[model samples]
Target: MRCKILIATDFSKAAASAADYALQMACLCRMNLAIVHIYSVVLPMVADGTMIFQDSLYDLAEADSLERLSALAAKLNLDADRLCGDGFKPFIEIFSAIGVPAAGIKSFFNRKDMGMIVMGIKPEERYAETLPGSTIRKLIKWASVPVLLVPMDFPPVPLRQIVFTSDFADSEIIALDFLAGIASAYHSDLLIFHNRISMEKGRLFLLKEKKFLDKVAQEIDYPKVFYRHKQKDTLEEALSVMEKNSEADMLAMVHKKHSIIGELFGGDKTLRMISRTQVPMIIFPQSFADIPGPARLGQNQLHD
Candidate 1:
């Protein structure tokens, strides 16, 4: 998995915050970074032929977008690959409308061995939605590699300490070495965490997860590693664990198909977990390996 870092931008100030965080992460990983902006002009209902064709506005947006990206690259002191692509629909739909920002990013970095993607999450604070963009959610769940999400207002700093959430999706994980290697690359302190509930089944599941981790520790020698299994059941309670630790620079998790807890709990649980984390979070797709399920892997109530 050798890929350069890719950061997509929209000239919004919130996006600028994400871009800054990406640069710091890129420098830490020492991976070549490519900053891209996908621009499109939507044809709104114009009463009459007020001006030029809708497509024409793309040029101005493109120019402004480029200037913004350039300024970011310069500020970061990074010589990154910069691009501005054209699309017919809004930027959010460009991915499914045709190819995607992910595909282009994959291909562009493929020649140079593109392997992972890092994107900005968090709504423009004014929007007040805690969820990520539909595009980002799709990519996080579907991307071939890891997609790291940075908060729109994350502080500028290095990603030296990482928290990898362990939901115990499987009895054994074959990728311990892979995870260890990546953690070692960044010289990061790997904090493995687990959230538990009072439910008997959930407790049993956590025990199995602990057993799996113990086996991994015995098999491979991972450095500077620590593990914490929280007895909290609610998402808010799980967040309290993060607040207690308060040392991770990023959050990492495997996107399980049927979270042992159910899709809604497994998924929303992570989102709520993210809500408490000040650092960026990276969701690793479950296809990578078999992990233990949480509590009710395939069952989720509307209230998850």
Candidate 2:
């Protein structure tokens, strides 16, 4: 996944902020970058002779988009050689990316070997609380590549601190392992936060997770280290508890294929959290292959 990065452009401040972050990340990570702007139109034609007029309109729109792309390319100071263009209409389908721009972006990222996708989460007058815009959330839902969602108005940081939630028992710490790997590479603090459900139950869950984490610790040490954010034992209180202490760069999660299904079908807290995430998140699918030999953790043992 080493292809040039893609930053979805809308020419808005929020979109430009995302572009700025992409440029900074590119320089820091030594990754190549691409700026993609998508324009879609629905043309209604009355007579067969209207084909010529519709073609002209399409060409004009495309030319305008390309001109904007060219201006952005210059503003970003990207050498003309590194700039590229990708244009498609309502007709093309990749990974079922029809009618949905986010799907198309995700499909593009996957097929291009792109390591990451970046976009802006637009802001509103309500700044204290932030939300991932509709399209951005859709991409988050679909993309496997790492994504950075810059807030329209929020400031960027070195991302020195990050928080990832885990009941600890969900899968293995494999999810945590991946996050820790990235956070470590950035020298960022890793905070594992999970709600404490009940006095005793939450405590026990904590203990259970800590035990698994210890096993993971044996496998890999974080001298830059780890912290357990014990929040109120209920979902309602969880975020408040975590927020009480400090802020984190990202809230990471795993789409334990089963967990995702349960959240969507079982209507659990994971679903609740998804609908009301205050921070941007990074989601990962479990792995490449599952063997039929045996089962490691029962679903009951893993529900968050």
Candidate 3:
């Protein structure tokens, strides 16, 4: 069974770019695609205690939202032939909801068929203000599926090299297991990156790194996996070095509640990276291991 990728759009230029990226990914990965637009209906403050036009207002808003979604879907369908080539065309669906964006998106998670959620982030200057209390942050925080964030004007290229930041946690392993599918499909190299502040050039640190690599080797069967270690004073500095050196097509990370990513979201560094990075990013939520899907193989089946 092919999984579906849910894309959230507000009809902005950034959102449109994200939709295009998702379309290409769906075709390449042989997954279904869905586009959703959420609109809010704000009613005027009436003098009377009761309002008679609430239902009509909601209906109109929903109608407009659906119409826009349809238009976007049509545009994407036109490019399906070019992207799919001789492969099977992915099934595309469009939907509209009336309420908050985060709540509307969470409703689709109940379907249990979604493998990922894709959204677009504006450029750096706008990202800081756009993230706090925004729908993107809410989804990143609580969504059960992996969230793929595409920066505006990001080049739509095949994913050849992916950089995954890790702390050698169990959740990071689970996230790697899930990402292996895409890496295999794209024939991409998976680079496991770890950064430490300690400048100890001793055998103990070297042994620790070797142990982590050995564990990954025993766990993940992918042959193209590699590891990279760096010494840096801060996460931001480490990220800068990784971004500049790796030349990766995408960045992947696991977001645990108490992890560095979780703490970064509370501040501005992660937001800056999200806005400044030229490549797309895939964030695996803390609950990724619990999500039921073919992409998330069980521990018993992982080695198979």
Candidate 4:
């Protein structure tokens, strides 16, 4: 069976755009699609702290969620012919669950053989106060597979160049290996960007950069790979400059728990970056490399 790309949608404009983006990716990667809708039924509590059992409300919620999911699947199927030419239609599935959005998604994800999770973020979510409770933030923090975030306004374009931010950590090699598979699929350039503070520049930094590139060359056999090193006062500054210079179609990075990107959901600077970044971003969890070889690529392996 082919691997599936799970799309979490709330039926909003942004969610629809994300679904479209995932559809394009699925066609390119020869993968299937599973669209999920997570809903919740809030129960009323009595003064004694007892909750009222509302079977009717629960049933209504489930029914509505299923109806919406079906509609979404139909829409995607209609677009498949136009987006995926030559009658190469991808198999599409729909699912619904009742609970917290993130928890519901995690439960479904754990049971499926999915390669990636794609979700859309609204422009308002870029605000600092709103980032903490955003579902995308929670998914990025915990999802084992890559989480691709598409800004609501981001147009779906062919990925020609993917800019990956790296810190030259050991785990980056594994991340790069995984990304090389994607680059190979699109025949895109994988630009490894290393951002350092201005003070860290000089011969020692150059040596470390050279060593990292050498290791990449030895380990990753992809010929279209390239590297760039830049110094700025902050990661956000470096990212701004890279965005202007790289002309990248997509941005990728591994989320280390202690790294700035990992703290993106909480940090002020990182939140700002998310708010202003226009390109789609794919964030790999720190432990993504730990998954078995087959599972990492969403091949013929069952995830326990």
Report the C-alpha displacement of residue 291, candidate 3, in angstroms.
3.2
Which window of 10 residues has the lowest lDDT sum in candidate 2? 87-96
lDDT (10s digit) by residue, model 4, range 1-304: 6667899999899898899999888776767899999998977656886666699889989999999999988988888888889845789999998888998888766654777889887867766434533677678767878888888867778888888888887778877886787777678899998777766678998888888889999998789999887777766677777678756788888875655554654454434555667778888888887876443663222121
How well does candidate 4 score on lDDT at residue 243?
71
> Please, what is the TM-score per model?
0.69, 0.68, 0.86, 0.86
1-304: candidate 3 lDDT, tens digit per residue: 5578899998988899899999887776778888888899887777867756779999999999998999999888889989898886788899888888998988885466777899887664355433433687678777888889988877677888888888777657778876676777678898898876577468977787777778788888688898887788766577767678756788888765555454455554445456556679888887787666554533223222
Q: Per-residue lDDT for 266 in model 2?
A: 40
Per-residue CA lDDT of candidate 1, range 1-304, in tens? 2235566666566667776665554444444556666655556676775776655666666676667666766755532222211211111111111135555455442333444566666554214325445566556555555566777778765556677777554522433444455566567677777676666365677578667777767754666777777666564566556656776677778765544245345456555544455667777666645422221111111012
Candidate models: Cα lDDT each: 0.55, 0.55, 0.76, 0.77
List pairs with backbone clashes in candidate 3. none
Worst 10 residues of 3 by lDDT: 295-304
Residue 133, model 4: lDDT of 39
Candidate 2 wrong stretches, greater than 4 Å: 1-4, 42-52, 78-99, 124-134, 169-174, 199-207, 219-222, 233-236, 255-280, 285-304
lDDT of 2 at 218: 74
Candidate with better TM-score, 2 vs 3 = 3
lDDT for residue 179 in candidate 1, whole number 0-100: 48
lDDT for 32 (candidate 3): 86
What local lDDT does model 3 show for residue 175?
Answer: 81
Ranking by TM-score: 4, 3, 1, 2
Worst 10 residues of 1 by lDDT: 87-96
